[model samples]
Target: MLTERKHTLILIILLVSLPVFALLHLNSGQIDLGIGTMIDSMFSFNNENMNEVIAREIRIPRMLTALLVGGSLSIGGLLMQTLFRNPLAGPYVLGINSGSSLFVAFTIMTGVTFFQSDLGMIINALIGAFLFGLLILFFAGMVRNQISLLLVGIMLGSFTSAFISILETMSHAEELKVYMLWSLGSLQKVEFHQLGIISLIVFLGLIGALLISKQLNLLVLGEREAKSLGLNIKRIRYLIIGITALLTGVITAFCGPIAFVGLAVPNMVRILFKTQHHIVLITASFLLGAIFVMSVDAILQLLESWMVIPINAITSIIGAPIVVIIVFRRLR
Candidate 1:
């Protein structure tokens, strides 16, 4: 009963904060819509005379993208932590982000067409991430040692990164410019339709994650223990990896390999909640991740108004120090 009440409180807090953060996001930008105009535009029942088009078309899509991407990355991170039983495990650990990056680089540089459309870029990225994730899963099945699996994943990431470097070196200046910009990451690029697709994919992934929450909780007790408890360890592992791959792939396809959100937010939630339950951890991580990204976006706009700084630059600037502190504290 207490646990249920606690979760209810958390949910209420998240529900309240989400809209406030969203409103802040809407009001923030180069153009000041003001609170009244922003509210009017949001409802679409009023502010018909104001810049309703800009609010609905531009800021709304961007805010939705932030929410979806942030939530997706956080859930992916939670799954990674459970799968690997490592605090540092994240979407990037299995080379999934690298896979997406490689595909995006190929699209930008070689103009490789998957479906003969710009959406081909996202398709190719999903392919790369899925394949890489499968390879990692295969190796994990073969290896009983956690450290070995970690090393293999790191090596795979390095291999994919080397391939991206090769493509970068061979690409023309124009192609390189496009690739570089994509690598920096931005939530502003998603159109309303694209946001719909992303939201759908993320929603499905989160549902899958929720369904496997019991299995994840078991897996946290160790593979042997999980098996002894009648859990299908192999099948559960594969399912988790596959779902995580899909989530990471889709997000990376659009957001350009957002870093550290997956690694940091789960740990932060664990520290705050002081529980290892997948249900609570997953929900908290999602909400916290959304809050974190929205906060970062808000900071980026504030900083951009003061100086021209890329969103990626601001994220790295803020994320790196926090990571370092976490590492230092862990060492002590």
Candidate 2:
């Protein structure tokens, strides 16, 4: 009862602070837009007014992208960690992001004009993520040891990286520049028009995750124990991978290869909540993850006048230290 109460209080605080941070985030961009203007733009878009246009077209989509990507990556990390029983597991650890990067690199570097479009990029990314997810699943079936499966995933990522590097060497300067810009990661790429599709996909993926919360709780007990409890381990594995792929793929398609949001956020939630219940973990992960990314982007916005920084760089700078601490704690 005490722990639940504590959790409830923390969640309430997070829920309240989310809007506060969101409002601040909306206002943090280069141009100063008042709260009244931003709210009005949300309800009544005015294209002629530059402030309204910036609020509706630029700031709103960026904030929403941060929220969706942050939450999705956190959930993906949680699912991967639970599925593999590894503290360090994440969405990109299984080479899903690498697969997306490879496909996008090929498409862009090869001068494929049709596939260079936004829609084409999304389709190719989804295809790459789905295929790589299946490949990891195949390897998971073959490997009894979870650590071995992780090794397979790392090797796959390394292989893809090598291929991408080779493609970069042969590509023209313009194409290479485009791919490099994408690999750096950013929340600004999403537009208001694209949010509908992105939101729908994220909503479906979150729902899928919630539906499997029970199975995830069982999986935390171990595969044999879960199977003994009448859980179909194979089916659960498929579901987790499918959802992770869907979330990770779409985020990568839009935001580029963001690092550590997946690996770091769930671990943070686990430490704070101190629970094995997926329902609590998932909800907390979503809220906390959204705040985490939004905070990072807000910092970028504050610093925009002085220096330009990639979103990926900022995340890595913050997430790497957390990862090191996790490693040290595990060693202890």
Candidate 3:
């Protein structure tokens, strides 16, 4: 358990580190712009210089995507855990990622650039996640076994991946390259231009999470207790599903299926903060989640001396262990 002072200090540390890491992300990648150069590009627009363009236009968008996706997914994880009353529950665990990935494959392989804009990708991802995510919920009701339900979700993901693979086989090289990169997951795809829509949608999700915080607290007491206290568990569950789908779909559409942060960050925050209050958990999750991901991304930049590791790969490397531990705990 953390002392109140320690909790305050941790929050302060996270708040301080987030901007520091964001700045590091802005300056640390391949081109290696100095902080002065990075700041100048932000304060003074420059169209001519390659360094400025890379600093202001390229890296900033990637940083924003990292921050937004990490934060949104972490909150989504927290929401899923609270709604399902299952510590191991997460957006990716529920087939949302695979569903979004499947539709994205369709868009890339079919050569339909019609809705290829950021808005279009979000729409595609939202539809895909909602369909499969809702299906998982429906199945959860039928299968009383949580582990079996999780297995079913995994099978759903595998089914979607098989479909994605079929699409890949039929796709031309150029199309395959596009689809492949999307599968690998990169912050590089998002430009500053796409930030507006991403920000609006993610902000909406965060707002929804905030509105439900109290209800979530009630839920932590258990469904029967919550119902006795006049809480509508069914309505809250639907709302959480909608919010989780929106956040997961938008982030996956833009950033691909960067995994683990959602599953890991919420657990880490709970361990560190030692509280389930949605007020504390949600805020801490966002701050630490953004910092955790930006730090991973920074490590990826620093590691450019060796190989350009994919964001998803690095995240899985770090998150997989924590997830395994959580599973053991769940089983225990």
Candidate 4:
């Protein structure tokens, strides 16, 4: 009863803060539109006015993108952790993000042009992430030990990084410049339509995660224990990995490879909730992830007055230390 009440309080806090932070996100910037003006512009739907145009077209989409991408990455990390039975596991562990990045780089640099549409980049990213995910799945099947699977994931990440470096070296300065900026990561590039698509994908992936939450909890015990309970461990593991890949692929394709939100948010949720139940942890992680991303984005906007810094840089600075602390604590 106390746990339920605590979770209810956290939910209420998140629900209240979400809009407040979003408003702060809207009001912030060099233009400095007030709350009343922003609200008026939102209702008017007429972009004839400058403030409305900026608010509607620029800030709102970016804010939505941050929420969706942050939520997706956080859930992806949670799924990875459960599947691998490793607290430090993240989307990048299986080379999913690196795979997406490689494909994006190839499209921009080598003129490979796999999917020649507005959504081309997203399609290519999904393909790359899926392929890498399959590779990881196949290798995981071959290996019995968890540590070996982790080593394989690390090796795959290293391979993808090396391939990206080779592509960078061969590309022209203009293409290289574009790829570098994307690699740095930013939320400023999202469009309204893209936000809709990202939101839908993220929502679907999260729902899939929720449906399998019970299986995830079972798997957290041990393979033998899960099997004793009649859980389909193999199928559940594959499903989790695939869903995680889809979530990571879509976010990376649209928002660039965001760092640390995936790694940090799940751990934060686990600690905050003080329970390993996937049902509660997943919901808490999603809300906390959205809040953390928006808060960081708000800070970035404030910092832009002095200079523009990549979102990834800001997140890494904050997230890496948290990761180290978690690792050391776990070791002890």
lDDT of every predicted structure (CA atoms): 0.78, 0.87, 0.85, 0.81
Q: Estimate each model's TM-score.
A: 0.88, 0.92, 0.93, 0.91
Candidate numbers sorted by TM-score from highest down: 3, 2, 4, 1
What TM-score number comes out for model 3?
Answer: 0.93
User: Residue 156: error of model 2 in Å?
Assistant: 2.4
**For candidate 3, which ten residues in a row score worst on lDDT?**
112-121
Candidate 4 residue-wise lDDT, 230-292, digit = tens: 999779977887788779888887778898888889988887888878988888778888888
Evaluate residue 94 in candidate 1 and report its C-alpha lDDT on the 0 to 100 scale: 58
Best by TM-score, which number? 3
Going through the candidates in order, what is the number of backbone clashes in each? 0, 0, 0, 0
Model 2 lDDT per residue over 1-332, tens place: 99999999988988898888888898889888888888889897788999898888889889999999899999988988898887777877678888888888887899988888777887788778878877887887798765577688899899998999999999999999999988888899899889998888888889999999999999999888999999999899889988888888889988899998988999999999999989889888888999999999999999999998888888888887876786677667
Clash pairs detected, candidate 2 = none
Residue-by-residue lDDT tens digits, candidate 3, 191-291: 87789999999999999899999999999998899999999988988888888889899998988888878888999999998877897788888888898
lDDT of 1 by residue, 1-332 (tens): 88678777876798689889987887677787676665666675343464666666677787888887778888987898788787766776557788778777888888655632547866877777777777877787788665567688789878887888898899888889888888888888777668777777788888899889989999999989999999998798778877887788888878788877787788888877777788888888888888888878877776677886666676567666765676567567
Better of 1 and 2 by TM-score: 2
**lDDT at position 284, candidate 2:** 87
lDDT of 4: 0.81
